[model samples]
Target: MKLAAAAGGTLLVSPNFAFAGEVDNLSIAWTTDTASWDPNQRLSPDPQTILKMVFDQPIDMTSDLKLTPGLLTEWTLADDAMSMHVTLRDDVTFSDGSKLTTEDFRYTFFERVNQGEELDIAVGFGTVSDIEILSPTEAVMQFSKPSPIVAQWLSFSASYVVSKAYAEKVGPEKMKTSPMGTGPYVLTEYQRDSRIVLTRRDDYWGDLPSAKQITIEIIPDPTARLAALESGTVDIATELSIRDVKRLEQGGTLNAVTNPIARIIYVTIRADGVFADRNVRLAAHHAVDKDLLSKAFFGGDAVTINQPTIPGMPSFLPDFHFDYDVAKAQELLAASGFGPDNPVTLDFATTNGQFPGDYDIARAVVTMWEKVGIKANLTVITESQWYELNASGKLPPASLFVWENGTGDPELFAGNMFDADLPFATYRTDEVTAMIKPLLKEPDYDTRIKGYEEFNQYLIEEGAMIPLLQAIQTIGYRNGIEIKPWANGLIRPEAITIS
Candidate 1:
């Protein structure tokens, strides 16, 4: 096996490997299962990881998180930032041997807009008004307003293109179970909450994947995933805890790889109901010791974050600080007429084993909040349930959630989280809505950064949400299996090589 330099100068397995022919099988133990087969119907992290294998996006991101071409060969944004022209690859074909053209791209982006239907992945296409098909391989995307981040959106989640004829024939309901796309792999078998099997297409348009067949077993527990990797039940195990990764590396047969991705683990505080008061929200924010949580759960592998944006991002605030003070938290709780004698009680939702150390970190934060006279009833829920509740705007007072920002764009991070119109916004207020609307459409780079900096300062003052820590992607695999770590944390089949 060859070793190459990865992000942060970490040594990882190189994609180049001497092989005679196609490898037979590659089994992986995944932390979560995909909620939907349709790529555009779901906006969560787990589904995107699986859907990317079958569907090709307009633009792709390199392992280092740089933009590259996927389905579209070339894309150029207009000078006014109101439109974008994209040229698709004419050689690509779906698994059923049908040519992939601009018609599929048009339907993938503008079909919902034409029917006046609500889009599940609204953030990517909120400003896209129309897609004018120039030819079989070219189209122009027209936006309702200036959209500077339109190119970046092409590489984000829910941006994958599907076969237009197949989708229209099957309709939306049947498309969820049976989906077709122009990609390297085809979804051969799917068992909800259990397993998924994908087979490589022999006539794929791009480079063939190393494995001829891929089996992904949905194992939600971190310990179970580690066990599977150790017992040789699977070749690769993803989303393992840092402690498990350290243990695996200490042993000889298994090796561990880790990369800090563009996702943030934070607690969302509802703007209404029990947390309607800003002082109560501030108390919750002050109670969490982000640095301590990082050390205890992640073994300092993850970096603590003060805001939604992380380091190296455009909207990252270096000087912004939200101190952890038990006294301050208690004082704020008292101001809200709650103390040790009459504790402030509320329900807190979190998922177990969805990500590395998610459950442990939530428990630690709950314990910290208890010290400040806040009685939080922590409830463990599934990822699907969390999404359902979030969409209905019925989440509890506080919920632990992970926001995936693959593009590292500020508009997708802070902009979507605080935008009053988006369902992801937990702290929706007239002031916050007014503050975020202008930053979304600002085409000037420096001006947009300045506006986000001011908006972040306002969010800190108002205690909009509790930003905990940046997430790290950890995967453990056997000696013979080679995998390159992506900065976005997705385990692509094409990036895996078997010896």
Candidate 2:
């Protein structure tokens, strides 16, 4: 799967500092900082990883994405499957030494559902009707219908519990900087866009971490992060491009590991503006060669997608895919009444290094569009700026976006991006909105598959989005440092050791 060439090759490897099996303090260079300290506010890998340190959800998922207990000791579902009962671990306590109770679970779930309009993870709880406390250590969560997947949704990081009393005393605004949870790490300092420092709690309920102090420095540029790793300043770096991985691994002072995640890096076109014409959008889709892009930018490590779903996912329809055809694209452009003299121009927005080789891929796509008589103007912005534009509905007609569904559920992708009420949705229409109801309400497994099939068919035929490729999570670490990488590209601080 190695595809990218060695980058500039200018970074010099320094001598190793820590001896084998001597991990005490560790520093990691992450591509982005937490958008919010409150666990339920934002949904992304960096923020989720940070929240996992300070907060613990009632349930957690294994690497294979199976549901497991975190704060809860046992769970039971009614025979009808409409209600779920879980018992909390009375021994679990927050960093402040307050015992965790069922009331904390009620407060977090209710708050998330009430603020569903602005949160991405809210889609997971669509069937949840109400949560009732049975006792101090037990509670019941009722759903509108039988939802077999609700337990897995509860394991998501967005469901991480916070102390109701602590949140009430501090208020929502203060919680953004200071959060209270029952995880193994205590956040001591958080500097916006700079660094976040956490210390291991002496009384953590689980096995103690090998490192006592953890520092996460935000370095947006991929090259700068690699340089820091080579200079012995940083022990681990995440989101490295395939090229950087090749260079670092070849240098022999560092090790690189790549894991394909449940994320799709694709392009979204706003149907209301420059892409109002269906012919132009379809033409642009056919103009770019996804296979070539996967090889050139990703070094063949990425999976080229035709529809929203990735290859290994259950809902992926291999029969329906868009192939590269220059002649077909030119014919579609001609039918649109736009030619070389009257080229259809579009503003393309993307980030520099948000993903692996993002800038290069964007430029390459623009060049491919130019060949089909479409002129695309490129705008490279920061990750935060891109999110802001999308949230405000000010994004350009065509923009690059990534949807990472760590749960590996088909509904997470279809519901979040197409559901009209959700904050992350981009394109909205009567046809797409109408298709969302059956997908969510259908309780039968076979029937749900049919709903997704029909929904994907509509999206492909209507060209709702131009599918690109699934990103591979690549981690670069200093030699002698052992770190476990999560399936969602999260580098957990508790899993690191010097050896």
Candidate 3:
């Protein structure tokens, strides 16, 4: 904590007292993204960075986190992979010294689903009623209905098993301050809205690190984050602007890398807004050249995409592609009664100062729309207020939002967003709800994939949500740390090793 005044009592205090362990030759600089540092509260990429320190278990993308062999290894899948029975890995224990058990998995899922903290993945397991504990180390997970994706959902870190004993002992609010997970790092200190410190657990079940202690300081300014990364104060930074891509170009020990980010940024139309008209929507789609905006704004790191899910992932239907069509766009608007006399006026709420040159992109979009007779009003908000407004679901006028679920499963991606019950866009669709019901129940992989492709196509063709650019996830680090590259930006923390 640092003082505000020249001599003292008026100190503008911070949470982390100091970095844990010794500062090593290789240090990582990253920003604390959210207002808080609770793992359960983490819904964005920022939280994931910190979560790596707090949890040591490696994820096996090849198997479901549930009923898999890890902290809790080996499980029984029924005749179909739909339901599973698993046994915990023996001898695993929490930092608090509670033995790992089936109850941990059971309670964690039940808690998150009820709390709605990490429902992005938990929605797949919504059918499971209870976990039957046959013994301390063993249990059976019976689903209300068979779900092939249950394991995939469980594989997410959010569904990670927590020590129920510690959680109850710590209590909810207290647990936020003192989380005990079976990871490489132990939560040592957390200052609300400021910073957090984690120390490598020497007694941790899995392999830890040569670095020893990891401190995550919550720096909101991406520029500030970049500065820290360059100045040797930080070892890694999250969400750097396209300009920073050039900043690192001058060359240093620092390196910048990009991944096909799970995040797909798109424009959302308010179901109740003026864009509710189909022609108004499709015309608006064609009016903006996504390719130009992505190139100018993202520095060639993004692809203009139409599918609700990421490209190359399961159930991704490349059948539909959206491109600029000026003539057809005008015709669609004319057919739908939207004309220059009664121009389609759009109010778009996007960010300008947040990312590098975001305002320019917003302006470019408005300019494109104007040629087709759409009067676009773009309002810029700071990143904080933007998210606050987004969380409220009343996306001001129109809004630009990004979704970053890296599971590579289309059902979870498209189904989670467009699915009426949990439309993150805040738009509701009866057809979407109908489409997902059968899709979720199909047991055959081929059938499921086919159904997913069809639903994604429908979402695109119907303009359920405006499609925009897909971001390649970028992670900049010093040369010492190693990262495994997957099409998805998510790196299994367990697989990471510092050289």
Each candidate structure's TM-score, on Cα atoms with residue i matched to residue i, is: 0.92, 0.89, 0.85
List the lowest-lDDT window of 10 residues for candidate 2.
10-19
Estimate, for each residue in 222-242, the C-alpha lDDT of model 3 and write its tens digit.
777788887878776666777
How many residue pairs clash per model? Answer: 0, 2, 14
lDDT of candidate 2 vs native? 0.76
Q: How many residue-pair clashes does candidate 3 contain?
A: 14
Candidate 2 clash total? 2
Ranking by lDDT: 1, 2, 3
> Which residue runs does candidate 1 get wrong by more than 4 Å?
1-22, 116-118, 334-337, 391-393
- In candidate 2, what are the lDDT values of residues 38-104, reduced to their tens digit? 8876667557877888888776655545455667766776655677887777777899999889888
| Arranged by TM-score, best first | 1, 2, 3
Q: For model 3, where is the 10-residue window of minimal lDDT?
A: 1-10
Model 1 clashing-pair count: 0
Give lDDT: candidate 3, residue 366.
Answer: 80
RMSD of each: 5.1, 8.0, 9.8
User: Cα lDDT of all candidates, in order?
Assistant: 0.82, 0.76, 0.63
What's the lDDT for residue 25 in model 2? 74
RMSD of 2: 8.0
